[model samples]
Target: MWSQTTDKQRNLERKKEQILTEIKAVQQLLKTEKTKERNVLSEIQDQNHKIKLSQDLIRNGQQQIALINRDVEKNQAEVAVLEKELKALKEDYAKTIVKSYKSRSSQSRIMFVLSSENFAQAYKRVQYMKQYANYRKKQGDEVREKSDALAVVIKSLEEKKVRQNVLLREAEVQKKNLEAERTKQQGLMALIQKDQRKYNDQIKKKRTETAAIDKQIQQLIREAIAEANRKAREAREAAAKAAGKKTGEKVVESSKGSNTAVFELTPEGKVVANSFKANQGRLPWPVSKGYISLRYGDQPHPVQKHLTIHNSGVEISTVVGTRARSVFQGEVLQVQVLSGNNKAVLIQHGDYITVYQNLSDVYVKKGDKVTLKQEIGVVNTNASGQTVLKFLLSHNTTIHNPQSWLSGSN
Candidate 1:
């Protein structure tokens, strides 16, 4: 549990870093936007992403400060304990020194030993004096050691205070940045609202193109599933005939649907599906470093208050040129191109299918096997300077939220 928590924290930090990288990419594009067609939507998206990132950074910084404060308090407590111990040690040592000073004379010491009742008594007295001296020396050394320890603790406390102050200041800076970015986003929203009809038209046009691309991807996946099921059926029939089973034995077929297709698997395929199901919440992310810009299911539109958008899968915003990787081992069933989404790769594991879209280049073709975390393709960076990958997971014809299947914090 502790390891999983730490991994989640690290994933959150990585996501923040990826957003920062995206902000920088947008800044560079804005600086170099000398072209005729300006992508206002890109700028708005960048600002919105940065605003969200800044808020996350502020929260992380505050948490860091709290952790540091705890350390400081702990150090302070330790210093107090050491101080008390050192003081007692010093007082004892001082008392011993004073008593020794009063009996410091060599003549006095000789008389004290001579005054013993017998030679044996005198020898014992001498031994007692030597032991007292050793005891006092040990006490003094202890006092010195404790004093050093206290000093070190004090220094550490000061350092923690300094770190806390730095974190506080950084949090304040992030808040300011967030405010500015939010204002910019609001301005963009206002501009869109000023000509709401035109903006709506743009959205409709984009939505139509996206729907067409989705249709093509769905068709490709359906065909791939059908083909795979055909092969599986053939293998099952051959095995059944060899086992002297009836020729009329029924074979499993692929279930057909509009957006998803589920293949009825053989026993081996069933095992694979069971394994994939067992790892539902422990699957690695398709992209190593990125943030979910858009999640699956219906969501309120980012700019329009009364509008809703449906996403079949989550969209991950990542750095340009980043490779899209497989979350688990599977067989590539389809690698096809779609308008605006670039290339799409669909892989099947047992009865389940995972689709990775918006790629520029694909590494595996149909029927090829892919290992866990294998690079499937390079995510395409569009003309707007945004590199986003759309990922989907399905069991049969039912879609599953990719976020729920991922291992790390969303």
Candidate 2:
């Protein structure tokens, strides 16, 4: 903002850019999100998606509008805050103006000059008069500057309200579009009935693949933990051997604690725990940017409301190839290829076990230590050719909702 000027302008421009970027990102997410994945998850996905889009629009508009309103209010508040100061200035200005008018009207600018008692005193009074005039001029200039700034702020507020109006209109369109999508999704569900056998097979394959992946992850983790423990043991023995030579006596283990951590809490549980333990309120974003599709617990599929299924994790919809990263530091217990052309990775953090399913590939193997915000794998796109992440946070083997841990990510 200020390649050439001051700090205030730079700070103002930085805030502007942050707000603008959020607005643009939300808009783009809405545009890029596809309709097919919503159908696959059932109407529940579609409804939530519509709601999310509306929320983003409303939120962005309201945020910007609020900032503008704050500016206007600040201007008004400033006027009030400085009223006493300005009042005194006004009195000084009034006296100066009155004196100047009389001195000029007398036509004997000379009589005014001769009114002085002595040469030094007369010279000093003239100088004082000129200084008072300049002070009055400065006060007038200040009032004008503040008034103009206030007007600009009010105008900006109007523009923000206008933008909010547009956002509302967009939200309505999104709602109607959501309704249309819901209806079409219902049709698709009916079609699923006709192809129930095929759909069931698909579901069965998905479950099998998931199970296989889970087993692989557990096995890999066990091996990795063992390996870590083994290495730690070797280091201890090595130190013992060195100490034995130095002191002529056998040495004991100095560092015996294992580096492994486990979060037995589900995603939601972990999120809650971490929220209190970490940021006090915020959760990390599971993926960089995406709309949540399936939420935690038993919810109807997007296509058929009658077809209820329990969701252990949230399915987040985003652009293809979007990488899934660790919301917090943890150890990789398992990574395996699941069905549906996807992979799954499980990590343990504290008492929390985070499970990220529906991945295209895994980056970390079993026993690998991953830090906060570490990339685990790219999200696997569904049949719709768009990335959909099945995110779960768990304690031990029990499921946790991904949303809680990623609350801060939003």
> Model 1, poorest ten-residue lDDT window?
251-260
lDDT of 1 by residue, 1-410 (tens): 43664465566567657656766755554444324255666566656766766776777776667667767878888988998888889888999999999999999999999999999999999999999989988998898899889989999889879978887887888888888887878888888878889877776676677678767777776787778877776766667676654566655533543223668777888998999999988999999877677778887765665767778888887777899999988899888877645889999988888999999988899889999999999999877667789999888657788889998645
lDDT of 1 at 222: 76
For model 2, the local distance difference test gives 0.62
How does candidate 2 fare on TM-score?
Answer: 0.54
lDDT of each: 0.79, 0.62
Counted clashes in each candidate structure = 0, 32
Instruction: Go through the candidates in order and give the C-alpha RMSD of each one to the true structure.
Output: 4.7, 8.6
Candidate 2 lDDT by residue in tens digits, 48-161: 455455445445445544554555465456656566555666676678778677767544656666898999978987787688668878878876665566566556556656
TM-score of each: 0.82, 0.54
Candidate 1 error regions (>4 Å):
1-36, 208-223, 240-262
